[model samples]
Target: MAIPVTAIFDIGKTNKKFFLFDENLRELHHEYFKLTPTLDDDGFECDDIYVLCNWIQNTVRKITSSGEYQLKRLNFSTYGATLVHLDADGKPVTPLYNYLKPFPDDICDQFYKQYPQDEHNLHTASPALGMLNAGLQLYWLKYTKPQVFQRIRYTLHFPQYLSYLFTGQLVSEPTSIGCHTKLWDFSRNRYHDWVYTEKIDHLLPEIVPASKTFQTIIGGHAVKVGVGIHDSSSALAAYMMRTQEPFALISTGTWSITLNPYTKESLTRDELNRDCLNFLTIEGKPVKASRLFLGHELDHHLRILNDIFHKEARYYKQIKLQDSFLKKIHNHELTPSFYPATIANPLLSQDVFSSDNWKPNNFESYEEAYHHLIWGLTLLQVASARLALGNSDVKKIYIDGGFIDNDIFIKLLQYYLPNYTIEVSHMPLGSAHGAAMIMQGKQVELVV
Candidate 1:
């Protein structure tokens, strides 16, 4: 007799991981690896498609052939805002282009002008993210990389492409397509009309429920493979599956995303401008979401802190959150200008960063200055989280992801969201857990 376990591959821009989960969703074994990226045919940097595919096959083959455990199921959870173009031979015809690649301004301008942005963007519940919208990548390819576009017999989001590798089946899952991709018309509950107008919809494979799985033959054994899900939705799925009531999940990482499954109204123009959008649940339900570059900003701010204070990197680990500082934050007495105006990124405007009179020079110590910066950050976080809290019944806010371990951050969040129940969820591999959760059933059970 062999031990049975579910195998999951969680793919991200910087890390590729494989995990084995026992029957109760506990991690049995895991492995992490990094594959160096290479330039595409156009000489632009991108993930090497062949190398990634080869690694996936060889690793899974080795795992199953070892006889340590029986591979009961297979699933994938990957970052969004990426597409994989496959030719008629069911193989990649183009590089797995980076979402951050510079999209031509003219191409973006043309796309907005061709469609009524106020109506279309609001209806789609997506912001004007240019190529970051993913669907816009098709339009860019159509006009800029016509040869590559012509060779595409099918276009699959990154997660689906990974699933196709094992199941040899292509699918369009709502959780992946409904992310701020600008492809699905939330109001219409299908691909936007412009997709048909441009005939791009033809290349899309059939839309399948994110909860659906199919049989696949691998390593001379039958396997259950999921259709794939967007990483955000997959992470949300774990909470959604376990909880039986309305709640908001604030996932903090490079980007801090707040997802609310109970929002009642459609997104307005203001929400879109503020980076508020909709994410389809694993059950194909709309989840109001808002994003902020909280963690990234924290990193950049810390780097500057290290340089200014002449301290070692990651010195934050040594400093402890003080009760006095927490009280100052609670009373709104810790007003100070931090994050020099020169450090402004696209995520948050620095015009509102207040006066720079309280720079590091003003503080007696680096620890005090860093705490003040976080105090200001908490205020911004409350505002960002509120965007996703619109018209929802959620009273409990669950904080998870990279920053959950920060006692000061959690304390600040609790202070700000005093009206809501705040709790820190130590589980960080939410996306992987979610992929496994969706494996046992097709339609997710929603608590009324």
Candidate 2:
């Protein structure tokens, strides 16, 4: 008998990736596609819904029809805080609004007044963020785009929307609902009263367990489909399944988010100002998380360095740094502080690094220059990671994603976080893989 295979659609803003995992949660084969943007009737840039639906349908068919593998199930893991509004016929009334589009300032102010910013933050377990908070998107549409909002029958988070395309079910997963949406009341474990107060309750789908299986017949194959999960929560699931002990995870990509699963503390005013957020696990428990645009900053500075030195930015392999250069950086006394004034664009600058001078002198090799640049980045990452740790006792720091591929970045992180054991994750397709694991109804060893 052939091993059972599960397919997953892992959707991101820039990339739509597909993965096939066998019964053991090993990746069998994977492919990725990019989404093209189309303007809606109102001339607002939006995701091409038809293209995505078609892609899902064709992909499912392709997987089932392939005689090489025994297809048994399917699931989805996607970026959070974006939703799709559907009509009575289950057709989208408008293009899927891009979350990157800014929410109106006045509307947010109105929400703050009614709920009180601090209380609302406490209730939702999510600090207020403009468009990133999915609930504000609904408010924006209801008040500003009244006509469009009225036509909506259901508002499904992006992940559930994809699952709905496959199973014809309208349900909410805990992870997606609890993410900075302002829709969920984490303390109460239900939708906030404001959902009905604003008459937007009908927009939300019925809540479903992330691990719930929705069975369907595709291409004459009986496949079990999952409700879908938030990308971050899914990533956490993958990590949790791998380890049985308490640990903190730093998932790096376009945005580097540090997540501490053990910390159940509420957000403070100061923490909120630093962009700290509380996310719900797939099981509906709060996971303390803070984000830094470390990847974005690294990319930006790399570009700046490349432009200035007229050389391509490459990885700095291990090489002996001159004692003099090391002494200069180490001996220079610098106080650790959050100097917001030095930040020209805090959102664009992922690394909290400030220096009077950063000119590169002629080094023996490119490795020396690379070390200097990465050392600066590592310092910022370490500080940001500490903020995420908060009052928790994290014994191990699990580093995952693209940062694991960078040797210098990992080494620097190891150097700074010497108190904790730094273990690099070996999981492939972490988010999608975790979603599949949830559907499989089993746990596997976490080999890092």
Candidate 3:
């Protein structure tokens, strides 16, 4: 008998990736494809459902027929805050709306007026973050696009939608439902009453546990399809399998999110305003997390330096600026106290002058100039991480993602956060690996 293999469809906004892992959670093969957005009849930007559906079908067929591996189970881990509407026939009735689409202003006003900001915040345990709140998207469609809304038979979160593509079943999983979607009542541990009160409960698919499994046959192979999980939560699951002690994870990428799985306290308004939010674990528990736009800012500043000095940004090596230069840049008139610690503002001239902005006017080497830039970026990241730490008893900070490869950034972070022991995670495929691990009732061994 052949060993059982699990296939994971890890879907992101830009890339749709597939991975096949054996029963021991070892990756066998992986493939990825980019998805293009298509305009709907009204010229609104939406995902090409047909393209995604066809790709998934073709990939599954090809993988199952390879004869190199026997497929036994399948699972999905995808980005959150997007939904797909299915018709009575289990077919998508409308274009998968992009979460990037703006929410209507009138609806926002009406929603706040009806529920009051504080009441709604307390009820949902979610901050009002423009389009990031998936529940608001449903409200937008109901009020602004009634025609499309009326035709919907069921709505599934993005990960669940991917699972539905293969299982031919519409089910909502906890990980997707519990994201900052404002759909689930975290305090009550059930769907919010507004779902039924607003008559939109019919749109929701049947709820299922994240670890629940369903049987499906594909290409003469019997496969167990597990309910989907959110990518962040999946990553956490993979990490938890390796460690039993309380620890915090800094998942770095476009956004550096510091997650404290042990912090179960409800978020206050100030924390929400600072970009802190709750994530639902695969087991349907709230995981407190705070996000910082460090990666975005770093790239922005690097590009600005590249343009100004006509040099590509070097990230791997450490750059140390002279004490005099650092002092001068810190005291420079261009530096603003309120300069947002985010990469949203790229123009160095508009914010603070770092080593990146230091031309040969007085500096001796390019290394010095680069060091200044690193100093500023590192300082911002440290401050952001401290804010995310809050009052949580985070003993060890596990850094993962692109920044872990940068020695200069890590060293600077180590210097600033001297109180906590910093460790870089070796897990390469975190979220996808976590999804695969959860399916087999196994855990990832932590590498120190």
* Highest-scoring model, TM-score: 1
Candidate 2 lDDT over 22-111, as tens digits, reads 888888889988778998765778778899889988988887887777788888998888888898899887777776676788998988
Better of 2 and 3 by TM-score: 2
Between the candidate structures 1 and 3, which one is better when assessed by TM-score? 1
- Where is model 2 more than 4 Å wrong at Cα? 1-3, 39-46, 309-329, 333-352, 355-373, 442-448
> Global lDDT of each model?
0.81, 0.76, 0.72
TM of each candidate vs. truth: 0.92, 0.87, 0.84
lDDT of 1 at 328: 69
Best by lDDT: 1
lDDT tens digits, residue span 371-391, model 1:
877766676677789889986
| Candidate 3, 1-448: lDDT as tens digits | 5556888988765557899888778777899888888986567797798998798889889878887778888898887888888877878777777766767788989888876877676667777765678978788778878988888888888888878877888888777876779887767877778777788888887776777777899889888887788887787778887789888888776667677788747777766655677777766677787666667666765675566566755742455434564455447523422234444323322323333433333434455545655666666666556555677787798888667877667776776688999988776457788888878864222110
lDDT of 3: 0.72
Candidate with the larger lDDT of 1 and 2: 1
lDDT for position 82 in model 2: 86
Q: What C-alpha lDDT, on a 0 to 100 scale, does residue 249 get in candidate 2?
A: 89
